[model samples]
Target: MIDATRPSAPPRRILVVDDDAGMRDSLEDLLSAAGWTVTTFGRAATALAKLPEVNPDVVLADVRMPGMSGLELLRELAKPEMPPVVLISAHGDIPMAVTAVQEGAYSFVEKPYEPHRLLSIVQHAADQFRMAADTKRLRARLASLSGLDRVLLGQTEEIRTLRQDVLDLAESEAPVLLVGETGTGKELVARALHDLGARPGGPFVAINCATLEQDRFEMEMFGAKDGPRGFLGEADRGSLFLDEICSCPERVQAKLLRAIETGTFNPVGADSGASSDFRLISASNLEPEKAVREGLLRADVFYRINTFVLRLPPLRQRLEDLPLLYSHFLDEFAAVYEIEPPQTSHEDMAALLAHDWPGNVRELRHVAERHVLAARRGRGSAAEAMSNDQQRSEFPGTLREAVAAFEREMVGRAIRAHSGRMDAAAEALGIGRRTLNEKIVKLGLDKDNWL
Candidate 1:
């Protein structure tokens, strides 16, 4: 019996328990030949002792064992999360078998059961168990998506859709490319993918491609011949997250493409290829096609890594979640500082939602921290701490006017701080340089004045 919905998880394993050694051997041989890894114990007590270690998909046991009856084992393993228990009953034990099945036993097989029938039942039970486990795990992940350490918190349509996408891709192994504005939490999504996937137990190797020097990147990614292993080696059997992938030079991109295509790399000075099986998750804040056209990214590399491109929407696109997201950060900081979260006013909410958050969620996080700090330090209204000027009567003109003024000041300040270098300014403002350029044109800011 095949289950279409069963998760591709651990292999099937069966535990057999009976005082009869011959019966145990027969059951092991039968189950093993049927493609189930089988472990057999002579006693129900011994099987119980090895239960945690075996962690079988199904337990096949004799109902009338001497030390601990299979009925007792059924009671012991009756948790809703535990695997199904199948009891082997004798001809005279039909009534007891019925009672056992009523008391949470999966089903009972008579002593003279047909091998095919038994295998069928076992397969059905294992598939159901796997289905239950996957459902429980998915529900748990969704519930804890926004834990204190994780920041993917929002209820807006945009955020909700993004969160669902993350969950859908979490269990998959195909390469994924993240395209989102900086500060939209691409790294966070990568972390979530690593944590929720099949390789959670393995290392998560993360590096910002933008920060890697060309020659240095090859050495770090492919490793040294004998002395050191690179990020590719470290990520074996796990995940590798590359942020700002558009910044990777053509030379590095070629080597990266080869490594990803073949799952093997020749370390510096190595004689032969070494393999590292890692799930590749790359992120680029700039529009991917634009980056390729601009010669910032390799077209071949882009195509290879973009098996699934997930786009995370910027905060302004999901403004309906502003209050929830801001409150989350306020609560987060308050707990860290061991102070009560300050009460934000209607004016504070207005200030927050009035403007487009150019820097996205990362900007909101910073603002929220500042807002909390202001109250902690006895400063006035939290919203005014960043965007409000007393002489401006909250804002200078229309909603667009108010938002534009705040955005221009913020973007210009970031550019000025970086001496008008767009790359540095973009990094400082938690946005791509292309996005910053668009912002500059839209806001009508003179970069020379800022410099």
Candidate 2:
């Protein structure tokens, strides 16, 4: 049972290229004994042809070869991105081998080299190759996130700042505390911090403190001798995110403080403590300051974990970003349900904007999903279709009526404030002149009063 999310080490491979048939065989046998897949080529040219296919971790080539000398082969293969090559040379060719190394070969060995010494050199190259590949892979993965990841989704000032804050926080080893209301996607932000950080390949272990009972919280967090490895142990060398940290029991809080301070924790029923090295990321749905004032959270633990803090803005506070979020979720739901995305009229948009989204972005996404489902089922106009169960408790009884009322009031005010100047009114309302005029005509507002 392999953990697919865990990064596996790159396979070890050695390419032996020596025109001497006996020497090639000996090198192959030695590397194979060292538990590496070895491939032999009689000529440097033949090895070059197989380089891409085999992609060996290290290349061992003879200094004097038939088609291409080892130095010439090094010239062709010593790319910054390619696997390291170690040249084998006779004592007399020491100077040429040294030149090969200067050109980017990892190292060179004399003809009468010790087997152990040669193995040690190749092992070093293998380790270096693995590290380089891992770094490249991690960089590629992080770059992919900047394009399609959801953490940086909105166009609001708050979102832009949050993205930059995340990047800055990721550059350190300090603990992170995320504070926001429920459904504000705190976990997503935590993951972004982990994925973009130095240990992207490490595990991202998460647990909801609110879900853990007082008696089980310690065991779940710190692990036990006879039981499974707890979250802390599992997240070693990675990150551990505890959601609703305010809900952590008093007893567990003390232990957590010790773990972070000492980098070790006593597993349940174990006499000796175990090492626990991981980044700590915590989230609290409640106002952390309020919680501390109320004595629900320990002041000491809060200080330790709150080294870096980020607050995710509630969706209602960033209403201008509603359209982007709506479209994002609309496409997601459409693809998930295999249906066309439902069109949202200006009135429908106004209704959504008018409602107070207590569930934040999570609530908005559900509404988008339901709207698409209802439209696919041949329901009423998008407004009426979403008027029933999907309507927020804070919204008016009928979505269409509420939308009409909101539009008339807001548009009329914008028009009156601008003295019926369509261009000024449109700009004031954050809309285009054509849009404002259409709303004015549809709502049957009298322009004479402001004009």
Candidate 3:
């Protein structure tokens, strides 16, 4: 079995920097024969110059050189981003090479070298360098990617169509209106519109309109003369996301509509001539049309910004995606907390899929985090609230009835976890596939729940 803790090593790159051309060629050929991609440089300066371009996993340099000595080259590449450097020299210079290793070199290798010993040292250095590089790359990816894609995970028909809609919307400059129930990832969709759009390089400024106090709404949207910068100015030449747009006060909505229509806005206390530039992206957990009819959202404002409307589907409507979404969150929290991800038992999976997920993807993520926390604290099973409160409230009349209910729930979860793969699900439940199928039938568990 492959150890999960071990990183898969990519092809190693070894940079050989030696002033002796014959020695450089010899080292390069030897390392290349050992399955490494080798680059030979006759001068340390040349190697340093090519460092960024070649990005060798390890550097093998002779201790003495004409201009830039191996020690000097090691110092130059001593920064965090540089790969490991191994210093080499003749027996007479072994002490100097050892001193170089003490300073920062990966290791010291003596001349009249043992081929296997040299290969072993270089291989270890390269593997360590590669693992560190992989970690850095993962962190970089986590920082740059907005994580909006995770919200729209799964290969279901609904997700496939939604992805296409998002791609189509990205090419347009029109204002986008996102509608979804609370926790259905409205904000994520709003971010996706801005991030995937043609103006992705521009800033993405977001504010929750519903949370803004009525008195401070204007000042927050439009900068005040003697107050802090407004979201409008901050989002100039970029996207301004107004979350819970339907919650914007009626009077403020009129002013916002004017700004969108005229491509200018009046800062709270600035001269009437002062104007702001920005693209608008709005979201509402409420149904936009209903909100307008109920006077919560201004009809005119809705018309002004509803050029492109997207509705995020609730989690319950996409039950088949539960396993994938659960795994995604599990992996995310595992990485964040630096712990091995906890496994979802048959019962735990059933509880996850059976829940309506009223809070949608956001709720599921929080639950997954809680599961991780619980597992770290030595609780191997799913947390009590893994199943919804309403569902758990039902009481079995007898102890035998309660035990049966528990068994049924676990079977259901196992099936769902495996996406109705009976053999795999049964194996996870430690039962033969035929026996599991019989139990499912006897328990009267709805196959639709897992399928």
Q: Number of the top candidate by TM-score?
A: 1
Candidate 2 residue pairs that clash: none
Number of the candidate with higher lDDT, 1 or 3:
1
- Each prediction's TM-score against the native? 0.59, 0.55, 0.54
Query: Counting only residues 3 or more apart in sequence or on different chains, how many pairs clash (N, Cα, C under 3 Å) in candidate 2?
Result: 0
Candidate 2 Cα lDDT to native: 0.81
Ranking by lDDT: 1, 2, 3
For candidate 2, report its TM-score: 0.55
Compared to the true structure, candidate 3 yields what TM-score? 0.54
Clash counts for the predictions, in order: 0, 0, 1
Best candidate, lDDT: 1
Alpha-carbon deviation at 428 in model 2, angstroms: 52
Q: Model 2 off-target regions past 4 Å? A: 1-148, 380-451
Candidate 2 on 153-249: residue-level lDDT in tens? 7888998898778877887899999998777889988888888887889999989886665578789999998897898999999999999887777
Candidate 3: residue pairs that collide: 350-413
TM-score ranking from best candidate downward = 1, 2, 3
Give candidate 3 regions above 4 Å deviation.
Answer: 1-144, 383-451
* RMSD to the hidden true structure, all candidates: 12.8, 14.1, 19.8
